[model samples]
Target: MAALLGPVITPEGPLTGQLAGDPFHPDTKHAAKALAQVVEALLRAVIGWLYRLALLWVMVDIVSFPHDDRPAALT
Candidate 1:
């Protein structure tokens, strides 16, 4: 989902600029910023899905394991 939505959600900026071997080059900075934004968004989406899954698991567990408060001889 992130791959499809990232381009639409990410802000447009100087994707092309000075290209040099230096790490501080404008082009590199722009690329890095864009990549970081995409990665962050992807991570957030994953976290959200995981959270939902955990909630579902808890609910299922509760339903599957009902507490039996009766005495051992009651059966």
Candidate 2:
């Protein structure tokens, strides 16, 4: 979504230079804001995936127990 709606275009109007100033000439402030938002979303996704993976690992560990006739240690 960000890739498609990135690089904020400045209209040929009065607030062109002042409002859309880019020191590096790489991206306007609006585009930078969009890029920052994209980065934040990516971070959130990564964290969410990590949490899900941890839960899956825990479930796997619990289910992979040695379910033999013998019992657990008493001590």
lDDT of 2: 0.71
lDDT per residue (tens digit) for residues 1-75 in model 1: 634434322135423223234568665788899999999999999999999999999999999895997988996
Residue 30, candidate 2: Cα error in Å is 0.8
lDDT string for model 2 (1-75, tens) is 534665546464333444446455445656778889999999999999999999999999989976675556742
Tell me the deviation in Å of residue 74 in model 2: 13
TM-score, model 2 to reference? 0.55
What ranges in model 2 sit over 4 Å off? 1-21, 24-27, 67-75
Q: All candidates' TM-scores?
A: 0.62, 0.55
